[model samples]
Target: MQAPTRTARTAGVLFLLTFVSAITGAALYAPLLTDPDYIIGPGADTRILLGAVCELVLIITNIGTAVVLFPVLRHHSETAAVGYFAARIVECTFIAVGILSILAVVTLRQTAGPDAAEYLPVARALVAVHGWTFLLGPGFVVGIGNGLLLAFLMYRSHLVPRPMALLGLIGGPLMSMSGVAVLFGAYGQSSIPSALATLPEIIWEASLGIYLTVVGFRRPRDAETTGTGAQESRAPRS
Candidate 1:
């Protein structure tokens, strides 16, 4: 048993941050975005602001995962690491756009009376933008990046157990299928099937976060063989 290097510890924390911020952001925004009354009625300013702030933090953490892991991942596959980073960035960009769309609703609500004829349609459009952003961002982009590329890297590198990584690998395609289904009007994004499709990915991410935070990544063989750095304790075999 050995201690994880400073970089591994940092990456572990970043992974946890990514998980927490994403979940918290969704919870914070769900209420404001789902209720039509929130868009039409007054006194949602605070909620809207809070939602926006959470989204911003989500963006930060989303990027943090890739950025923090890049160094270690690059050692295994530089191309994949860069691709994963790019994918996360793309996901965050779409999410940021979605946040702006929802924020537009807040701005519109503040400016227009609930009963105003122009209010409902414009608000609906804004919400639609946000909805599409969600699909494109989390449903598609995340499946491609976080679920697939990240899992592939971790699997090859043995950063986490292969089974845990397999969950993500399997989940990614399912999520992508669901995203396509949503795109084609086969089902709603919030449908049970969609949730089920994403469940493996969710579990993989959460488990990965917990694993990294608790045990950190296995020391790369090069590092171990060279005796160039502090040897990290290996995560338990699953």
Candidate 2:
């Protein structure tokens, strides 16, 4: 009913949308990601095109989450709040780059002649670029932005339950570390270890989204002491 409550719900919906778009995009991209010779074969351009659309949605929702939450989060810590917003921008940039790379692959497939050998290497190279972007953007930056920064803000402000915040606290570092491992060739990107590390951060975001959408932010009892002066001033003093 109130502006703040509306903002929380908007942010929650954005977060949930990010989840759906990201997963759908990734799943749709399987043909290119998993098949080395997909470019030479009868390409699934339609599927790839749909995947691109999903990722485009992901970019919008990703930034929306940060933008909607910035006002409330800044009340607790302006620096971190700004950092989260910036991180979201950076993540979206990576997502955009990845989208372009795959779309390029699709374009090449459409234009290539009967001699597909020449384009194979080029296609593979484009796929590689997308892979790196995926790792760096969602894999690395997400841990810092959503996992550590966002979680820390929620934890400090008690916007959500402490236990939910703890998931991010623990998951952020793990996800980042796993990304580094993948970057260094310690393990494959989709390895069990990487998935294990990513699990907590996923849970954290999902839980936060559901909680904010269903219940809205709970007014912190220690609002006066928590640096949320604006929120405290709005409350009636006994």
Candidate 3:
């Protein structure tokens, strides 16, 4: 039905948004991880710019995802619905981090007057906020939370292709674990272990994005419509 097509399109968009967001984070901040004291111009213009760009992408993507997710809920199983809502909440938090951190970055960039440590206050604050949000907040807290929900939801829902649902289930736990690794790495608790952790997070994003894209655009009718129709479909034979 038309609904399936529309839902599929939205799923594609979610994939696009998340994929781009990942790229932005990797490209921009990865450099900072290597060099803590690196500066662009006077007070680390390069770092601030990178941070802003990443956040900007996230802001736009989260907004897009939020728009599509409402329609998306209509098609999910109860457990899937729960997982979906949890992901939405996580997305919102990510957006909040993007916005707040961006503001902090811009504020420092503007106010800084060649004091090497000038940007540190704002940047550190923003980074600190980011540290909690992305690593502690989204990665560990929300990521794991949603991952578990999605995994459980996928297990319970019979509407999707078994393979696809199973894929989602598999990805969910991995994603949560990736978040944990990312958190540990971001906090600098363990060097090699933390570095190892990020690989999975990125992989989880890519893998999940790929699965959603494939399933969304295919326009295949899975348990979503079957379940929907059953609720609305009456006992005409009786």
For model 2, give the 10-residue run with minimal summed lDDT.
Answer: 220-229
Predictions ranked by TM-score, top down? 2, 1, 3
> Model 2 — TM-score against the truth?
0.92
Task: Provide the lowest-lDDT 10-residue window in model 1.
Answer: 224-233
Taking the tens digit of each residue's C-alpha lDDT, what string does model 3 give over 126-236? Answer: 656765666554455434433455434434433234454455455555556666655555445335655454444445445545555665532223444645335334545
Provide the overall lDDT of each model, using Cα atoms, as 2-decimal numbers. Answer: 0.80, 0.90, 0.53
The segments of candidate 1 whose C-alpha lies over 4 angstroms from its true place after superposition are 1-4, 113-115, 220-238
Using TM-score as the measure, the top candidate is 2
Q: How far is candidate 3 from the true structure (C-alpha RMSD, Å)?
A: 5.4
Output the number of the lDDT-best candidate.
Answer: 2
lDDT: which is higher, 1 or 2?
2
Candidate 3 accuracy as lDDT: 0.53
Candidates arranged by lDDT, highest first: 2, 1, 3
- Candidate 2 whole-model C-alpha lDDT, 0 to 1: 0.90
**Model 2 C-alpha RMSD to native:** 3.5
